[model samples]
Target: MLFIFGISPKTVKTDQGQFVCPICKTRSAYEIKTQRNYFSLFFIKLFPVSKPRESAVVCLNCGTHMPKMVLDH
Candidate 1:
């Protein structure tokens, strides 16, 4: 018998909204996401294998990831 198992990183979007991108300097759509490592079996995610990473604000237009503090404005 053969078994396949591994760990992989996964990022999930938690929220989306409009915000001013610090780099773009304009109002644009942004996504709030968190990343975590997960245990995988046969290429399928089974469970979390590591702690959740810091959530970030990703600008859709510019594809730039900014700090969560950007949402305050």
Candidate 2:
């Protein structure tokens, strides 16, 4: 019998919009992402291995990820 299983991290985009990035210092397109660890079988994701992490706002222009608090400021 052959068995292969592992845990893998996956990042998914949950939302998209425009925001003023603190690092980029300009309004740009952004993607809201959530990262989660998933159990994989033979390179196929089966189930989540851990809780979903806090969402991060990623800037498409400068490729920087910032906390949601940046939107409040």
Question: What is the C-alpha lDDT profile of model 2 across 1-73, one tens digit per residue?
Answer: 7989999999999999988888968889999999999999999999998998999999999999889888787
Q: Candidate 1: list runs displaced more than 4 Å.
A: none
Model 1 residue 19 lDDT?
81
* Tens-digit per-residue lDDT, 1-73, candidate 1: 7889999999999999888788989888999999999999999999998898999989999999888987876
Clashes of each: 0, 0
> Which residue pairs in candidate 2 collide?
none
User: Against the true structure, what is each candidate's TM-score?
Assistant: 0.91, 0.91
